[model samples]
Target: MIASSWLLVAFPALGALILLVGGRRTDAWGHLLGCATVIASFGYAVAMFVSSSLAEATDVALYSWIPVDALQVEFGLRIDPLSMTFVLLITGVGALIHVYSIGYMADDAGRRRFFGYLNLFVASMLVLVLGNSFVTLYLGWEGVGLASYLLIGWYTGRPSAATAAKKAFLMNRVGDVGLALAIFLMFSEIGSTSYAAVFAGIGDLSPAVITAIALLLLLGACGKSGQFPLQAWLPDAMEGPTPVSALIHAATMVTAGVYLVARAAPIYNLTETGRLLVTIVGAFTLLLGAIIGCAYDDIKKVLAYSTVSQIGYMMLAVGLGPFGYALGIMHLLTHGFFKAGLFLGAGSVMHGMNDEVDMRKFGGLYKRMPITFATFGLGYLALIGFPFLSGFYSKDAIIEAAFGSEGWQGWVFGGAAMLGAGITGFYMTRLVLMTFFGKERWRELKSADGREFHPHESPPVMTVPMIVLAVGSVGAGFFFALGDRLVEFLAPSVGALSEAEHTALPHALIPWLTVGLSLFGALVAWLIFGRRDVPVERPQNVSPVTRAARNDLYGNALNEALVATPGLWTTRFAVYLDNKGVDGAVNGLAAALGGSSGRLRRLQTGFVRSYALSMLGGSFLIVAALLMVRFS
Candidate 1:
């Protein structure tokens, strides 16, 4: 099974190829193939997990990909506990999303293409996790980026979708540059890019070089994981289909960053500054996401921001060094379960409500869609750290780990994590209240097409997956958190957690504090939104803070001012230079040559008399020049 690890990626890749090449011919059953491919991959991944757990990390090289004089890169897969864990998440959740998409996209003419894209996304993410070398990872990294762009812009008719796709693509590219440079630096300094070679050689590299590499990797992680400075694209990505949202946010694209950081633990472990920077980025981003999530009316956008916050917790966890690497991955796994469930549940709601996304237009839907309501409610509970749920186990573990850090770092990061939990509870509760609990706003509202609103339950194809995922959302944390089994299983890759000598908060009190804050947030939201008379119209008057959040806290504005505007101006300047300087010089020289040739053309007037006159004139001038030189 370990030797057959290549099949995990091959299954989806083959499916994508068949679906894409077959085109409309495959439309009748293409989605089935897509779901089957991912399901098969999940089965194989489970088998590999069982097999790999009993053995050490195994490297299976398929072939020599790039074999230069000094650089030897192989198309290889690493079968280990860490990679196995991700394989399960990507394929397992990805399979569910594919199944859900069958119903979600049933009416669309391009359903076949959508499934093909989903298969491609799964294949790319599989390659990202399974690759044994950075170069191979990068190949899958770019593939994931390309697939995301395609999926996000799946509705080509929607301008917002197109813009969102481009934004996601361009922003990811910015971070990809960092990853690419880090790989180059590894090849130059370490003389190898293989995990084995790099990890072994990393010890000899200077601290500065290690820090530089770590930071670069973090930048790439941020872009993919929706972390700070590069997170603006994620909420906009809500313009994509909800299934795309579930796949990217929950199981595949965003988790790539967390995986990258965790995989590069050896490098990060070498530099205190690098690790601290990771912690700082995580803390800041979690708060940013939580705060922004509070103000969103678009249901999917709210979930999108929640994803940003959840991923931040993962980042913060791994940033704690060995103490939190496994913990970070644990949270990532649980988050995949609940967040994907939440998004799918959101999809079900949309399917019922004539595709209305604004929470303001949704109310008292719990009766119309009980399964979605229950599933989404469970996921919401898990997300807000409801006790004994998946999030409570993983998220609270991260908070505890944060507090375990010595000195002010612990207090700051722990506090931020705690605050984010509270805010998460507040916003997610608000979403639930607005969408499912209040008066039935749909009765008085109309859908975007100006049709009468009629809310109903989605078919079992969608709700079933939501139920399965909701079960995971409720229990995955408990299973993974039991006796620290996840931590021990991941110990070989992430390193063992050293016992803490001091903590800002007591271990026994951490969960209580987290749960208490979460309840507080939930209560506050219930008071403000659940019990109050919710309004349907967009308010003309609101707090400045609410307005700021609606504007994405001016994140896009800053990006435009800092990156896009400057880039546009620079491009315009380059065009001007090309036109006036480069083109002008070339055209001016051509004109001068043309003018001089025009006079010279008279000498070649296709007549012997004309040639003789020109020759005689030239000869006289030569004679005059010679005489003057002789006299001087």
Candidate 2:
């Protein structure tokens, strides 16, 4: 079974091809095929994990991928702890999302096409994780971008969805440029793009060269993972189906950055400055997302911002070098379980509430949606790092690791991470109270289309996946952290866990202090939202901080001021140069040639006397010059 590990990608790719090619003729059961394909991939992954010996990394070669002068690349799979870990995650969570989409998109006319895109996405992500070389990984990376664009813009009738998809594709392209250049640089410097060659050759290169490569790779990771400056696209991606949100934002695409940084641990291990930049970006982004999340009333957008914040934590973890690689993966795994559950739970609420996404219009829904409320509550608790929950085990470990860093770095990053946790608690608690605990605000309100609100539970197909993920949200941390099992298991791939010798804060007090801050944040939320009369219409007059948070802390405004405005003028200037400089020069030369030629053509008038006169004048001038020369 391990020998045929390539089939893991082939299965979903085949499903996507068949469904898409089959078109409306296969509409009746395309979704089933999609779900089955992912399930099969997941089952095969489990089989390989159980049967194979991956103590050292196992390379299964498919074929020679690129064969050029002194450059060689192979299309292959690396069966190891790191790749296998992502394989299980992509296929497992992907399979659930497929099943849930059956209920969510059941009534839509494009369900078949949606499932096809879903399969395509899963297959692409699988290829990304399984590939052993940078070029191969990039092939899958572009495939993911393509699939994501299709899925996000599925609702072609909606202008917002179309714009969001374009925004996502263009922003990701900026990062893709960085990744492609990194690969080209690797081939130039190391003469190979294979992981083994690149990692082994890093020792021979100068520190500056290695740092350059790492930073470029980090740029690509940030683009894909929704890190700062590239983050605005992700929240807007909520225009797609809720299941798309759960899969891309929660389980797969956002975590790709952490995986990249972790996989490149060898290079980062050699560069202190490179690692510090990553930590700084992660720390700032987490706070950015957390601050913005507290002000959103749109249920899905709030969850979208929450995803941005959590992925920030993961980035910060991986940015800590050897100390946080395994820890980052650990948080990533636990976050997958809980965050995916939260998004799905949000979908369930929307399903019952006629697709209304505002928390302002939602109130006391727990009575009508008991299963959704319970599951969402578990996910919420886990996200906020409630003690003994999955988040507690994974997140607190990251906090501990951050605080243990040397000198002022520890306090700055650690304080940022802890503060992010508190803000997460406050906003997520606010979301819960506004959506599930306050007075039934829907009683006095109507849905977007003037439809009456009659909230109820979602179908079992959707609820079941939510339930399983909720269980993970509750217990996955304990399982992964038990005996440090996950760390030891992942050691062979990322490297052995490194503990810092110095401490900015007592290591023992980290978890306690972290939990205390979260509780305080949650307490404030309860006081503000839970106990008050829930207002269906949000108030206009608010503090400056609240206003800033509501405006995404002016992230878009910053981008517009910095990138969009400059880019627009630069484009116009280029156009002007093309017209007045390049084209103008060419047109002037043409005009001059035409004028000179026209004047010369007048001498060729179709009259014998004119030709004779011109020839006689030329001959007389030549004769006079020759006579003068002879006389001299």
All models, RMSD in angstroms: 2.0, 2.2
User: Whole-model Cα lDDT per candidate?
Assistant: 0.92, 0.91
* Per-prediction TM-score to the true structure, in the order listed: 0.96, 0.95
Worst ten in a row by lDDT for model 1: 497-506
Evaluated with TM-score, which candidate comes out highest? 1
TM-score, candidate number 1? 0.96
Candidate 1 C-alpha lDDT tens digits along 1-632: 77777999999999999999997889999999999999999998887676555346789999999999999999999887898889999999999999999999999998888999999999999999999999999999999999999999999999999999999999999999999999999999999999999999999999999999999999999999989999999998988899999999998999999999999999998999989999999999999999999998999999999999899999999998877899899999999999999999999998988888989999999999999999999999999989999999999989998988889988999999999989998999999999999899889877667877789999999999999999999999999999888988888787876554223335668878999999999999999998787999888699999999888888889999999999999999999999999999999999999999999877666988977887899999999999999999
Model 2 per-residue lDDT tens digits across residues 89-162: 89998898899999999999989889999999999998888889888889889998999999889889999999
Candidate 2 regions exceeding 4 Å error are: 498-506, 595-632
Considering every candidate listed, which one attains the maximal lDDT? 1
